[model samples]
Target: MDEYRAVALGTSFMMLSTTSFIGMGDIVTKKSLDWVLSNPKIGNSLSILGRLMDDMKSHKFKQKRGHIASAVECYMKEYSATEEETIIELRKQVNKAWKDINEEWINLTTIPMPLRLRTESCTYQ
Candidate 1:
């Protein structure tokens, strides 16, 4: 009977450990992807700007005029600027966005699981 109890306890512990490991991995991956997808518009805007920079540098400016024009139009719609001013403004916006994301990541790490659960439970209650 004692040996049977020992085996059952061992099995329960192993199962708990496996479940916890899988749950932790899934939670981390989900959070990472959530952060990536949270600001799709910002990412798209940055990507468009990066492409514009590439086009301008490579003198493919003519080939990519549509995208360049669209980017310019977006920039103009958003802010007033010369070329240098536009670059500085864009850099500032990107840096601010990154700072916000870093703060969110820090917040996620600092919350204890029990506190998080209690807060969530209160929300539902």
Candidate 2:
């Protein structure tokens, strides 16, 4: 899919997974006050991956009966790609998101270590 739609889907899916952040353990600490609480790309990657995978599995069944449009729909509409191509590209996105999360784990962040562990636990659950 096109770059713009890909980013939009990721970000939208991130927002859609807001429940996943409920266990972020609050981020008003000095290090992780604003950006960590507000715009956490590393954690968002997990949500994006989950959303894309879910959409890939459920889109065809849902769309056939005129349910909500998914990331698959957006990609197909934006890039004129077939379902197989869209799913393949989405799988690539999911893989890249996992890599991003892995990289985030390897690097130290401004985020506090304890809250990081909580975020990890939240995702794992």
Candidate 3:
């Protein structure tokens, strides 16, 4: 009988501990969700802008590479001196744009999540 009683008590304790942990987790998740939802606009805008910038940079790089290839082909055909200069300029522009975009991404990541949320909320309101 004593052994059975001990088993029941242990089981009860285990159940309570599990329940408490789950409840605490739920509370924390709810709080975080509420915070994010409250400032949807600023957060959403930043995310959208970041994605747009990424797409634009990718497109620009592809276009620049295509132009460089065309210029190289022209140079091969005619040995035109200006073709090499054009290729160099295209490469420089692409590299500079890539560097600037990378720097912007780094700066964006530095913003605190909470502050971003706050800004988003203020913007919407």
Candidate 4:
């Protein structure tokens, strides 16, 4: 899958919750707010992880329902990969996204721990 499509689809799912956090008034300072706005990598990672995981779990059901194609379908079509191979590659992507999330959690020290925890925890939901 193209990077933009993957990132866009994933990030769209996260926008509401991320906005809610911003709306909560926790990120009050200009610097903290700027940090949140500028450093979107963690949010992107969460979105990618969530999206791929959901696709892995639900793509078959969705396909049967005639729903729109998921990342699995897209990946398979784009690369001529079998379903099993697509899943394996997607799993690798999911793993990488998790690493990105954890790395951001540890490295993005400018943002407070509570906010970072909220960002990380929301991925599981």
Candidate 5:
């Protein structure tokens, strides 16, 4: 897979997961949904973290089963990087994503603490 496609898949996955969690928490009103939609950085950050972590852990297994390229593979191919180098760079990105998540969470004063917790809790697991 290419860079764009890998990123888009991750973003879509994150949005779907985040939205479902919020909906389950009964916080899916128009205003709340709008806020979630408008402020996507946190979700995107979470997506990047989740995608890279999963790919890093499962890439070998997936490859053994003939799965398509993951973000790790895409990065390696695009940059002509070794696995170790790719992993190191991806780890840096994951750390940045965590930082972004914390920053966004701190700035989210409009949402109730409980609702905010509900949205972020899923990402922890």
Candidate 6:
């Protein structure tokens, strides 16, 4: 979305959301929107981390053609680091993203629960 420039995770997440509105409609439609709008950090971090990972995996193929600038490229440019160092930093970023995801998900429990709770809601016979 940022056109080969450094992009925030929220923008990546927005693009991801566009791909499969069908699936996301059911999953991230309502409650998720509240949190996403209220505190975009969670979703942004997820998408940013995911984008870095995706770019890492596909950088070789993407580099040859009309691919957008990935996190790797952005980081290398920003930090003036070698490819190896950029990847190491990106992986560290992914780990950090997971930690952020865990924290947000746990905190978001205060919102409307997922439908999965219906199953567990049943009493033991």
**lDDT tens per residue, model 6, 17-100:** 333233534665565454434535555666656667788998878888867777777778878999999889889978998788
Q: What is the C-alpha lDDT of each candidate?
A: 0.40, 0.69, 0.40, 0.76, 0.73, 0.59
Sort order, lDDT high to low = 4, 5, 2, 6, 1, 3
| Models, CA RMSD each | 20.3, 4.2, 23.1, 2.4, 2.7, 7.8
* Runs of candidate 1 exceeding 4 Å displacement: 1-63, 68-72, 109-125
Which residues of candidate 4, in runs, are more than 4 Å off? Answer: 3-10
* lDDT of candidate 3 over 43-72, digit per residue (tens): 434433333333334544655676322333
**TM-score for each of the candidates:** 0.36, 0.68, 0.26, 0.83, 0.81, 0.66
TM-score of 6: 0.66
93-123 per-residue lDDT for model 2 (tens digits): 9999999989988884776676566566555
Q: In candidate 1, what are the lDDT values of residues 53-124, reduced to their tens digit?
A: 442344335435543243333454466656566556556655665565345434654334543333223212
Model 3 clash pairs are 42-120
Q: Which candidate is the best by lDDT?
A: 4
Q: List candidate 5 segments past 4 Å from native.
A: 1-28
lDDT by residue (11-86, candidate 5, tens digit) is 5634664555543555556666666667467777877777778988988898899987787788889999999999
Off by over 4 Å in 3: 1-29, 37-39, 62-125
TM-score, model 2 to reference: 0.68
lDDT of candidate 4? 0.76
